[model samples]
Target: MTTELRNTEFHIRARDGAGAEEHGPYELDIDPGRTADGDAAPRYASLRHASLRILRLPPGGSHTFATGDSEWIVLPLNGGCTVAVGGDSDTPFELSGRKDVFSGVTDFAYVPRDAEVRISSAAGGRFALTGARCSRRLPARHGPASGVPVELRGTGNCSRQVNNFGAAGVFACDKLIAVEVLTPGGNWSSYPPHKHDECRPGEESELEEIYYFEIAPAHGSAGLGYQRVTPSGASSRTGRGTDVLAEVRSGDAVLIPDGWHGPSIAAPGHTMYYLNVMAGPGEERAWLICDHPDHGWIRDTWPDQPVDPRLPLYEAPDADLRPSLNETVEAGPRPSLYEAPDADPRRSPNEAVEASPRPPLHDAPDARPEAHPEDPEGDAR
Candidate 1:
């Protein structure tokens, strides 16, 4: 059953359904343009910054599109492809993608705005075009899988693997921030309910987020998971709030305009994966979130508990395997968007936490750094 809430609507739950089509194998497409078509269109138009499209290609298939005013990343969900960008004399980027989301991390390509882009695959596969409207036209580049920082977040059942491939400081982008999360069956990620719907200096940044999910199959049957988004009260700037509670499966996507979202629960026996795409109106490209007061205490307990043994699903690539940025793509030197005063790109999330002085668990919520100590530098979501 495919469902969508329309106009000024804050929460949108898009379930995968037969007959839901969007040019070729684009299972779902959410952009600022979709919201202008009134009730007939998907009610995600209120989203001004972030956009997402899921494309599935058969063996030996290809697709082409214009970037317009947004920068985009061609990320392979499964399989590999060649990304050709218009106006560039450089050779097209060759993404040696993985077998599936459950496999190892995959490489990606970033294309600047106002350019023509073509993606072709000799052997068909699925890809996610994650995008965000922006002003600067950064150079097109390739992101190697080995450079992606993999972090294990939370403890016990909350344990999950975070692949910070397009994370703010990890990759250079004008307004987009994207990452992949993998949760073992029966565990909960995105826990303790959090929100980034307001700009509160160092506390939170008002970013719109999209959650696209894919559940691993159990034997011959499909698997499922649950997503929750509740209102964060009325806001003077955006008016009302947002709300949603849905069972999500493969090809499912949930849009969050303004609300507290959490506990993305995976059913037993079925591992879950979700790609998070985020962007906002803020000039500073950082991800700062405020946890719900009711659940904020959960962070305190993590220090005492042991992380689930199943964590660190996979390790980061060895240093020797990492390729030089100049050899991979033709990109200019750009400062990191989410750099902290003392951030070290070379350190892992866990290593950073160990190196820094531990803050008291009872510290005032607003006093915490822009990002959780356990997350990549400058990222709290």
Candidate 2:
């Protein structure tokens, strides 16, 4: 790759975990303000299509935003809120405060750019409501994932989900493998100091990765964290391993244009979550990453560990909850109404898990590690 393709930066933070615990009841204070973990004005043009706004509501108080040609995901960062989409006077979705909440577990809600969507809450809590000009695509297939959903247990690392976009219904603007992960307290995520700019055996992703962090200080205030990434090849021994070391926090995004990344170290007392967005220019549209030669051996040691205990589930924490969304949505029966939103009217954008099931690319692909125990720290060697 050309050096020009190496565009990257780690916008430093104003202070370490300054607003780790939010406080306020402002309309649009937008407190994060460019801090590493702090929310700030987005630099991407697409952001215009999507506006991420943080609202601080007074206890028992509420707020609303009339909609435009846009959809939104209302996420409560610290406090809880009740989002009344479409002015549902009867059963608007109610989200619990720092408690196990159901009903509002959607990745996001689809609101047309034409209608108005509203939000409300109690006790003036803090919440994040992100807006996006979404072009609704066909929902991905549900049911059992075709390929085995592996349970990776790396040293000091936690559990994670990896989905190659090649599966039908899975969106693919480029070669991107969407991976979600939950890093436990005292654990890490992307480790082993591996590189993937080049394709390799058992690993075939040739795309760049973007890590979007979501931290939960559910138990304490503030934390220490860092992601060690370096350039592979001759650069390691010559000290040119890399010039990048990102100290991230919630809301922070890091772009891995190329190189080896590892040891996503959690601070002394905090938990973390991340969504990995990958994309490349290959026709196969797969995740073909190659590990640094010195570190490929680590994958063999995963069977001894377990997944981080923070992943989401639809069924009774172990059962499939897809059918509970609604019995009459007619996921497979009607291909026109609930199937095509634009062809018809945008039905309830919530509970779309039953739309379609993605096909497994390979019949019997790789044998993924089972639910594993958290790996030990300093095991990334």
Best by lDDT: 1
lDDT score of model 2?
A: 0.42
Which digits, one per residue and each the tens of the lDDT, describe model 2 over residues 1-381?
A: 322232234322332232525323333222112435544345331112223355666667776665443344455545565666553333254544333212112222223344445557665565544443334322212222222232223422543333221211132211223434555667666765655554553444444555556566645565546776668663344443344677777656555546677767666556665545444444444344445678656655554544343433221112233332222222432221111011112121111321336232233322213211111221221
Off by over 4 Å in 1: 1-21, 34-42, 234-237, 319-333, 336-381
lDDT of all the models against the reference? 0.74, 0.42
Clashes of each: 2, 36
Q: What does candidate 1's lDDT look like per residue over 1-381, in tens digits? A: 112352215333443341345445677777775334432244554577889998778889988999988999999999999999987876398999988988778889989999999999999998999999899887788787766767667766777888888886567788998999999999898887888888887667889898999999998868999888877853324654566777888888878877888879999989999999999998888787777889877666665566676766665444325444443322334444223223436333244244447432211112114332323223223
Best-fitting candidate, scored by TM-score? 1
